[model samples]
Target chain A: MQIFFSPFSPYVRKCLVTAHELGLSDRVQLLPSNANPVTRDQDIIAKNPLGKVPTFITDDGVVLYDSRVICEYLNEMGNGSLLPSGGAARWDALTLQALADGILDGALLARYEDVARPEALRWPEWRAAQLDKAQTSLAHLQAHPALLAPGRVDIGTLTVACALWYLDLRFPDFGWRERFAAVAAWYESFSQRPSLQASWALPPA
Target chain B: MQIFFSPFSPYVRKCLVTAHELGLSDRVQLLPSNANPVTRDQDIIAKNPLGKVPTFITDDGVVLYDSRVICEYLNEMGNGSLLPSGGAARWDALTLQALADGILDGALLARYEDVARPEALRWPEWRAAQLDKAQTSLAHLQAHPALLAPGRVDIGTLTVACALWYLDLRFPDFGWRERFAAVAAWYESFSQRPSLQASWALPPA
Candidate 1:
C-alpha cells in the first residue's frame, strides 16, 4: 500500500501515528505530494477529487482518502487492535476520534485563513470563531482526559494527540496547554512514545 | 429515539431524511432546540459538547451528534439498509459523504461570517475562499454524477442533496446550476421525493 502524504498536515500525521501504533508502518510506503486546498495536484485530484492529502492506495490498487476512513481501514486490516472491539465503547471511541478530527479541522482553517488570505482581507472574528470551536472541543477532551488511557489508545486518543501536536507546531500562542492542563499532560506523556517521537519531526513552516 | 433538531440545520435535515428513507422516522421524534453556535446552549452542550443540532438521544439514552455518525447509527439500526454492505463501495460512499459535508461546512462558515460578524470584521476574501471550496466540490460531484446512483441511496447521495439544498438556501447567487447542470438536475429530481420534500423546509433566514 502507498499513502499519499503532506508533511505539514495533522490529518496525515494521525494516519502515520495509527500506522506506527498498529505495527504496520513498513507495510505501507509514503509518497509526498503538494496538494493544497487552492493549488491541487493533478495526480492527487485524480485519486481524490477533493484534493486532500493522506490518500491511501492499497496494495491491490484500492484507494481511500479522508484520514478517519483510512485509519479505520488500517485498523481493520491490523485486526481491530487500535479500535475498541464492540458496543458503546466503540461508539465512544469513534465519537472521540471525530471530535479530535473536528478540532484539527477548525485549527487548520484558522491557520489557513491567517496565511492564505491577504492581510487586509484577514477576518479576526472568523479566526476567533474557529479558535472558539477548537477551544471548546479541547476543553471537553480535557474534562474527559481519562478517555486517553493506555487501554483506550484507540484512534480517538491517537488523533487527539496529533491535533495537539499540530497546534504546537502552528499556533503555539493558542494557550491550549494553560487552559487544557489535563489534556496537555496526557498528550505530553503520549508524545514520548516511540511512534509519536519518530513522527514528531516538524514539517516546513 | 428522540432527535433534537431545528428546521434550518442541514445536518438535522440529513438525519431526518435518513430516518424517513429507512422507515425509522416514526421511531425518532424531533424535539425543538435553540442551540446556536455563537451563543452557547448549556442544555444542548450537555448532550453534545459541540452544541450542534441533530443530536440523537437513543431509546437507550445514548446521545449521538454529528450528522455523519448519527446517520451511520441509524443505518445500522435498520440492518445496514442505507450504507453499502462492505468493501470499496462502502468507502466510496463514505468519502462522498465527507466531501458533501465539507461543502456544507464551508458554506455554513461563510454564511455565519456574513451574518454574525460586523461588516468591518467580515472578510470577503476568506468567504470567497470558502465559496471556492464549495464550488469546486459541487463541480466535482457534477462531473461524477454516477457516484450519486447505481446503488442504494447511500450517505454520499444524501449529503450531496443536503449540500445543494444548503447552497440554494444560502447562496442563490452562486449560480451552481449554470456550471454544474448535471448536479443541479440530479438535486432537483432528488428533492422531489416525499422524504426530501418533508425535510426540505428552509431554515429561518
Candidate 2:
C-alpha cells in the first residue's frame, strides 16, 4: 500500500504509528505529499477529493482515508490488536481516538490562523477558540491518565501521543505541559516507544 | 441516549438521522444546545471537550461523541443493520462516510469565515478554498451515483445527504444543483425519505 503523507501532519503521523504498531509499516510505502488548503496536490486529490493526508491505497488499489478509517482498516487487516472487537472497551478506544483527533484538528486550525492566513486577516479570537479544544482535551486526558497506560498503545493512544507531539513541534510554547502535568508526563514516557521514535516527523525546514 | 444538539448543525442532523435509521430515535432524546467558537456550552464541553454538538451520553453513563463515534455506538446498541458488519462492504460504507464528513467539515469552516468572523476578517479566498472541498466531493459523488442508491442508506449515504442539505441551508448559492445534475436528482428523491424528512434540520434562526 502507498500512503500519501506529510510528516508534519498529525493525522499522517497517526496512520504511520498505527501501521508500525500493527507491524505493517514495512509493507507500505509513504509518498511525501503536501495536502493542505494552499498546496493541494492534484495526484493526491485524485485519490482523495478531500485533499487530506493519510490517504492510504491498498495493494488491491482500494483507497482508504481520513486517519480514523485507515487505522481501523489496518487493524482489521492485521490482528485487530489495536482496537477491541466489541462492548464498552471498543467504544472507549474509539471515543479516545475521536478526542485525540479532535485535538489535532483544533490545533491545526489554530496554527493555520497564525501561519496560513495573511497577518492582517489572522483572527486571534478564532485562534483562541480553536486552541481551547486542545487545552480542554489535554486536561481531559490528564484526568483519565489510564488511557496512557503502557502496552495499551492502540490507535487511540497513538493518536493522542501524535497530537501532543504535533503541538510540541508547532506550538512549542503553548504551555500545555505546565497545565496538563499528567498528560505531559504520559507523553514523556510514551515518546520512547520504537514506533513513535521511528516515525518521528522531520524537523521543520 | 441524550444528544446535545443544535438543529442547524449537519453533524447533529447526522446523529439524529442515524438514530432514526437504527430504530432508536425515540430512545434518544435531543437536548437543544449551542457549541460554537463564540458560544461554548459548559455542559456540552464537559461531555465533549471539543465543545461540539452531537455529543451523546448513553443511559449507562458512557459518553460518546463527534457524531461518527456516537452513530457507531447507536448502530451497535440497536441491530447494527444501518452499517455493514464486516468485509469490503463495511469499508466501502466507512470510506464514504469519511468523504462526506470531510465535506461537512470544510463547508462549516467556510460558513464560519463569514458568519463567525467580523466582516473585515472575512477571507474570500479561504472561504472559496473550503467550498472547493464540498464541490470536489460532491462531484465525486455525482460521478459515482451508485453511492446514492435508494436502498443503501447507510452511515455514508446519510452523511452525504446531510452535507448537501447543509450546503442548501447555509450556502444556498453554492450552485451545487446546477453543477452536479445527478447528485441534485438523487438529493431531490432522497430528501423525501421518511427518515430524512422527519429529521430535517430547522432553518437557521
The candidate maximizing TM-score is 2
Q: How would you encode candidate 2's per-residue C-alpha lDDT over A77-139 as one tens digit per residue? A: 888678888898888899899998888888899888888888888888888888888888888
Over A89-155, each residue of candidate 1 has an lDDT whose tens digit, in order, gives 7677777787777778778878977887567666676677667777888877777756776545788
Each prediction's RMSD to truth = 3.4, 2.7
lDDT of 2 by residue, B12-110 (tens): 889888888778888887776768776667888888888888899999988897788888888988877667888888888999999999998899999
Best-performing candidate as measured by DockQ: 2
Worst 10 residues of 2 chain A by lDDT: A196-205
TM-score of 2: 0.95
Model 1 residue A141 lDDT score: 74
Give the per-residue lDDT digits (tens) of candidate 1, residues B1-205. Answer: 9888788789999999898888888888777688764566667767667667877888899877678778888887877557776677787888888788778877887897788766666667657766776777777777776776533477888888888888989898999999888877777778787778885333354
